[model samples]
Structures are given as structure tokens and as C-alpha cells.
Target: MPKSKRNRPVTLSKTRKKGREHKEAIVNSIKQALEDYSSAYVFTFENMRNLKLKEFREQLKSSSRFFLGSNKVMQVSLGRSVADEAKPGIHKLSKFLRGDAGLFFTNLEKEEVQRLFEEFEEHDFARTGCMATEKVELKEGPLEQFSHEMEPFLRKQGLPVRLNKGVIELVSDYVVCEEGQPLSPESARTLRLLGIKMATFRLQLVCRWSPDDFEAYREGLDLSDVESS
Candidate 1:
């Protein structure tokens, strides 16, 4: 003698609903690049510097394209298995699509591509959570780099300092940051104020593909080297 239960409605997860459209766009763009470019590459990046990457893209704007997105979608665009591979053997490249990976499509010769990636680099201020490359100790004296007006700001960043005769002076020696330790917010600010740049932005070519062949690439890859089946 129990009453009938009412039907319940279900809500879809937000990520599933939002990600579909974005994934489709990426797939289309990747497929287009694969079709139009004579050569393709798989790349991974570290400590990405957006402005530097933007400039890099601008440099290659006329001759090449770069795609950064989910590796799963990229693998799907290239075909995850041999039977459905986008190109004759493109499925092989799918295995390399891991980490902060992306696709680079261009018509440039292999040597030129290798050279461009090697020479392209930019240095920037380190951020919080980045490991300090070296220890920094500030001597107890007038810090000429900052003005008297900045004394208060520096103190808030945990530095023991003051103003003297329109100059910012340190009351005692300060350990700004330690090598191999993750940078803290205060330490990063102090390093920036002291003009210490500890981050280098660069691109590395992992592998490349041509219609006739494919190969793994590394810094100083000789023109004679090749890897494909």
C-alpha cells in the first residue's frame, strides 16, 4: 500500500556541456592545419610567457600556425588509432601528445625551424611557486634601486628597511630568496623590485612530420638525421 513515486529530473555537469563546443573548434582548427601545411610538429613548453609566445607567433604569422589545447582532442583530430588516422601514418604522432603540448604547422624547412626555436628566448620576472635559480642576499645599506617613497611598500613585503636622506636603506641584511626553494609572493616582489629576472621563456621542437617522412627533433639536430618507418 505505498504511494507512487514522482519522476526526478537530472542536471548535466557544467564541464561536459561547456567543453563540447570548445573541443569541436579545436578539432576543426587542427584538422585544417594538418591539411594546409606541408610540415607539422609536436611541441611542449615550460613556464610559458604569454607575451613572448605572442611575439613568437607574430614572427611566424605569415608562414606558420600554432595550436595549444587538450591533448585528447588533438589526438582525436590526428586519429587515435591506425585504422582512423587522419593521414597515412599520423596515428604515430598521437602517442607524443602529452603534457603542455601543442601542434605547430608550417612550410619552413627543417633546418630553419630548428634554428628559430633555438634562438627564440625571453627572460622575465619569476612568479610565486617558481623555484629560485639562485640565492639572493641584500646587503644592509642604502638600496639605490628604490626611492624613499617605496620604503613602506618594501616593509610590507617583509623587508626591514627605512628612508634616509630621500633614499631607501635596509636596516639589516635580508635573505630575499633561497636557491631551489619555491618563490613566495614577498620574495617575487622583492626580486622584481631589485631587477632580478629568473625566468626564461623558450620553445622546444619535439618532433616533426613531412608527407614523405617523420622524425624526432632536438637541439642541434643534424641535417643528416632522420627517424621514421
Candidate 2:
């Protein structure tokens, strides 16, 4: 009888698992947004507010879709190179995905979209770790903005203060925050109590793309001036 062939050692296959259905879903949604609208835009935002964004979405629900997600995924959806660009010259948009960027798909006329973006502005209190856009200093005197009852709380927030005859008074000038520095927790709280809003929420149109054209829509134009003009 021939000797039984030695059993071969079992080896596992090196195939990786396919578990990224979520990324695929994101890509598909982006593609849908791209195809459903007449045009697409790349936008950048600063100090975004979720509720405000939701409100903006609702306001445009009938005519547009706004997509904020992974930049890499969006770039993939739009195409990384000219050969596979979602539309002619659309790959140019992928280059502007530098910061807090998102895609806006709309059927509204281009000028209308630009006007809407220019008009959109939200103001909010600066959070801790947010850079101060300007110096916030409290003069050495009574803080009339805050009531006497808030003196204790103000003191607790690290402000040099005391209740002098039913008034909250700062013992000396206090630098709550300095321009170009991250706002401190104490400073942020104090600023809020003083009713100071240092953060401005705004969206900017970086570029727009259509089947026939792709270009930077509002380069060097002051959005504020545009809105006013």
C-alpha cells in the first residue's frame, strides 16, 4: 500500500474583512447630493452652531442640500483627479478642502446662493480655548453690567471683585482675555456674564462647480460689503 500522503498544514486566507459599509453609504449620499442639484459649491465655516445649521437646512429644504462630513470621503465622491471627476473640472474643488469645509448642493440661482450665504451670520459667546478676536479688559471700577447678587459668582469665576454697598465692583483692571491668546475658562465665564460675544459664526463660499464651468465664485470680495451693497 502506498504510504498515506502527509496531511498539508492548514493555512488561513489573508483576506481582509469588508466592514466599511458606512463609508460607502457616505460616498453614495454625496453622489446623490451631487446629482440631485443643478450645481455644487464648496464652503468653509467658522464657529459653527448645530442648531443654526439645522435651521439653515430647514430654510433651504425645498431647494437644496448641505453636506458636512469627512473631507477625504467628499473628495473621493467628487473624484480625486480629472479623469474621474464627478463633473467637468469638479476635481478643482477637492483642492480647496483645507479647513472646516462642506459641500452645498442647490438648485437656486447662483446669485441667490451667494446672497444667502452673505446674509447668514450667527453670533455666540466665545468658548474656552477659543482665540480672542480682541482684548477683553474690565476697567477698575464698579461692574454695572452684573448685579449685586452675582458678585459671589463673579468672585468665584476668578474676577477680583467684591460687593461694595450693593454693587459688584472690580478691585482693579483685569485682563479677561488678550488678542491672539486662547480664552481662559475664567475669562470665558466672565465675558459671558458681562454680555460679551466674541465668536462670530459665518459660512463662506469657497468655490462653485457646474457641468459647464468651475471657478472660485467670490474671491477677494468682502462678504460684509457684498451683503451691504
Candidate 3:
């Protein structure tokens, strides 16, 4: 019952040195993938949705593995330089692991792999600060889609709405959102309530590697950093 130890001094070394084990685990996993799969590809993602990605991972679990974290650790695992590379000619693939990127290891036919990646896309609700994909406007009329109880909430969200005959009604024309502009917090919430989805989650191939050859899909994959390191 004397003094509290909550404010006592403590070292910050562990926070800086932590995750070494996790990094080693990733490195080992990638090295093992090198042996398990015949081909590897580096890809970039936009607006990631984890639940959807998990479902996707589940679908491909039989013939592939997905690695999506810590670009620096991944670069080290694949080898940043020729001398340290786990496999020959594979370190070049590391350059493309710059931002929002991950690695794919699979033995599926290249055609099948290409088809899967080219077609995989997800649509999700736009969060605040996300760009509106299309303009959304409401006319001056009864919004039969919403119940009377929602009238108060709609007005609070900047909508000119009211209750009419036990239905939510818009008293004046309202532009909930505009195309090619960032959605406000209120607008984003409105979009969700209206069942509108504007965010497109997608993945694009950056580069590919194999035992005998390599292919570059897109250009300028931040090569200078890898070159200098």
C-alpha cells in the first residue's frame, strides 16, 4: 500500500529488437516455398479486405501459399543480393516487394495462375476519405426504402429528410455524394445505409520468377533501393 510501480523506469530495447523470431519464421517459410513450388510471383494489392483474402487463401490452399507482410523481412527471405539469395536469379523479384505487396508461390499451370489473379477482385463499402466511384443523388420525394424512424438520423447526416405518412421523405433534392471526390464521414455512412459499394479491392502482378526464367509485368518497381542495399 506504499507506492505504485506503474511509473517505474523500463528499457525500450525489446520493442526495437522484437519480432526477430517472427522474421526468421517468415524467412524459413519463404525458403521452403522456394523448394515446394515451381514458380513465384510478386503482386500488389489495393484496399485490402482480410476476410475476403482469407476466403481466397482457403480456396487456393491446396495448390498455393500466400505471404502478405513485412516487405523488408520478405526481401531478406528471398535474398536482396545475389550473394545472399536463397535461390539463383530470385533476388531480383524482391525489388517489386515495395509497397502493399506480397508473394505468391504455386505450382499451378501458369495459365490457371494468370486467370486466377486477373479475375480476382472484391467490392467493398467506401470508408471516409475513399473516392466516390459514381455520383449519388436523391430526388425530392418519399424515400420508401427507409422507415419513418430513420428520418431523424437522415436529417442529422445533412439530408433534407422528414417523416411523411410513416415513411422517410426527402423534402428537397440532395446530392449525397459526388463522383471523383473523397467521401466524407457522413457521406460514407450514408452510402453504407444505401447499400452502395465503391471501393474496388484488386491485385496486380508485378513480376514473376522461375528456375529457368523471369518475367517483369509492370515497370519501375523501386529497383534503386535493392540495388544500393
* lDDT tens per residue, model 3, 110-213: 78888898899999998999889899998999999887888888888999987877988888899989999999999999999999999988988887889997
Sorted on TM-score, best first, the list reads 3, 1, 2
Write the residue-wise lDDT of candidate 1 on 118-217 in tens digits.
8988889999999999999999999998878898999999999988888989999999999999999999998998899998877888888888887877
Q: Is candidate 1 or candidate 3 better by lDDT?
A: 3
Ten-residue region with minimum lDDT total, candidate 1: 220-229
lDDT, each prediction: 0.86, 0.85, 0.89
Off by over 4 Å in 3: 1-18, 219-229
Writing each residue's lDDT as its tens digit, candidate 2 over 1-229 gives: 7765786676687777545787788889888887789989999999989999999999999999998878988899888777887776777777777669999999999999999999999999999999998998888999887788898888888889998899889899988889989988988998887788999999999988888776676567333421222
Collision pairs in model 2: none
Clashes of 2: 0
At residue 47, what lDDT does model 1 achieve?
A: 81
Query: What's the residue-level lDDT of 137 in candidate 1?
Result: 99
Candidate number of the best TM-score: 3
| Candidates ranked, most accurate by lDDT first | 3, 1, 2
